[model samples]
Target: MTQATAPCCDANPDPRTLRGCCIGLSVATCLLFSGATTAADSFWSTIQLHGFAAQSVIKTSDNRFFGDSPDTSFDSTEIGVNASVRLDPKVLVAGQVLARRAGDMYDGTPSLDYALTDIALIASPERILGIRLGRVKNPLGLYNETRDVPFTRPGIFLPQVIYYDKVRNIVLSSDGAAVYGSLYNDLGEFSVTLVGGWPVLDDNVQWTYLGGDFPGTLRPNGSVWTGSLWYATVTEQLRFGLSGALASLRYAPHQNDILGPGQTDIVYGIASLQYSARRFTLSAEYGLEPVRWRRYGPLLPRQKVTSEGYYLQGTYRIRSNLELMACYEEGVADSDDRDGSEFAGVTGGLVPAHAMFSKIATVGLRWDPTPNLMLRAQYQWNQGTLVLSQLENPDFPRQREYWTLLALQVAFRF
Candidate 1:
């Protein structure tokens, strides 16, 4: 049956925000009492609990970006539980909860910010249409849809080269709703979507000393809107798809907050191409952003920031249990506000020029000894360039950073 009428299954693993976890309790309750209701007659109303858990161990010679220490950091583990229930034949409800190492999450920061990521309801009355409300992915890019699960991704992490909007986990997911649908013909299926929402900000930002010892983030709240469109085709031997996305956010400065725009806007544009052959998958993307600012308080600068980036990744099936993967990416950021750039500014200086660029080469092996388990090992060499030396402090290393890691993941569905 098509997804629209297939009797809503458990929530897929995407909703991992703050309140998303509440949905999990719903699943646990149903699971504890659902055994008595199973029959073909109401089979569609069954409940399912889904989850994604992962742990990555890296032998870091230096915490390059995380200045806590320039030496070896501790091994980290991140786990999340997502429980979903098919409330009705046409509706699905889900909740998620996550636990990451104190020094990790969204960024290399130390935060026990164990809060809900997303809590929402989804309905797909037809294969051509789907709607979700509550905390949902803003639907801005290809990666955002699949980012919550590492095993479903092409890389250990979505290339930071182009995914740096993650600096402050900017506009990751929002408290809102979205509608998506597709038009199908004998030839292909074309899809479209429109999504908008607001983000709940937590006190997790680190502010630089502002003379009198007051430090905090500006624009405590930012308005956000994210949307996208795509088309897909599947032939006997070849499958292809085309997609694009947009993200826009506005932040108004706060009183006494030094590192925020008087009023700021962020926009992202992206296009991707994908092709699959007998045992190979190839994907490439190009993205651009034009950041604009206005009404800066005297504490800030007046300026416009624009940047662009691209990445290409390919996976080759070497054996039934192995694959070869590699990708190359680079981005250029230019800002009118020198010192405070990236999330809240202050990472660099105010000059309209290439702010920074990152280059990385990774080769890895994937072994799926069991259907629900995997073992992966990879070696990566990362190099970054910053227009100023100060920008190269921890993250943008003036020199090359090298690391080799072995990671193991095991998961199951009940």
Candidate 2:
């Protein structure tokens, strides 16, 4: 599913601007059910409606991220509404519509984030099995499922190393079905999930893989297979998970194109761990993706490389409503050439070695003035430019190897 821009429901150019109307719709839906008779109250009780909106201002000493950050950009925004309803004791339906704007990567086009019908096939106090059919969020790492929701995230920005915003659309969600199971006992709880689907792809995915969009179309060659295994302590103080995916895509070139028809195969995996206490939390996730490109001719010959990313982070609550966070993270475009020296040499210095890797250290503060309002401020020191987007920073050769960034955000939810 390629999410193309479309005219708004109203006459507005961007759907994000009509968020108020969407919220009003939510309110109206709730009110309409408020007058339900006693016989119909059970159905109304099963309905749940919620929405969230967030805006952020970002400034960077150099380079572009989410926008022309060097000039103090406010190009990042998120707005969405989600609803869920129980159709029966063992059946439920849920969905979300979202509008997001992020520099050159995403426009504020309204899109279906997810829509799914979940059915429990086997239910018991100690074990359960279910399946979800329709569009569903991929359970990639620890955060991909709720990546766009500010209220559910630990910070304004998740670690770029693991969540590449430039190609987010490729991994955000998929259209198909997923089977999941969970078991509970005194030892702990264990869960497993398997999903087969076609993920939504967009221009960002093309740019990230092909360097640029040629006179051709990129489409999924087949369905993607993703799986995850997780476990948590009995006290819910510790948890860990292993997740992975296999995906493939093909290119159909034009009559006289610069490239030949090519195929891309990707193998992705992530390991996550976390520990939580009364006021402090520690977490880490490491990811590896091996990409193979084939049949692309001389200009882009067959090749394979494994990229790596990982982060270590900790958060401490200063009070019931305030928290402080610190993190260190790194990303390498190719594990075999961690310094990108071989890559730079092959390109004759046309691209710098810094373009292949990045290291960052960050500190931040988050304050919850109320249950529905959140404010956050963060500062980051970054080295290298691996995560910078080509669409947003055309002058890639001139990109600085070191930079600093500061961001402030406010979010509201209901």
TM-score of 1: 0.71
What is each predicted model's overall lDDT from 0 to 1? 0.48, 0.82
Q: Over 4 Å off in model 1, which ranges?
A: 1-45, 60-70, 102-127, 165-168, 202-216, 220-222, 235-261, 335-355, 385-414
- TM value for model 2: 0.90
lDDT score, candidate 1: 0.48
lDDT of each residue in 1-414, candidate 1, tens digit only: 000101111111223343533433444355435533654355445545555556555543333332222343333444556655554444455555545542332332322112222222342333456666655655555676546466777765566655652243344566556677766666665667766555533222111111111233333233566677766664423333333333333343446655454444556777776777878888777777676555545644656666667788888998866777887776555433322234324433332122244455666667767766666665556544321122113223223333333333343322
Q: Taking the tens digit of each residue's C-alpha lDDT, what string does model 2 give over 245-274?
A: 899989999899887999989888999999
Q: Where does candidate 1 have its weakest 10-residue lDDT segment? A: 1-10
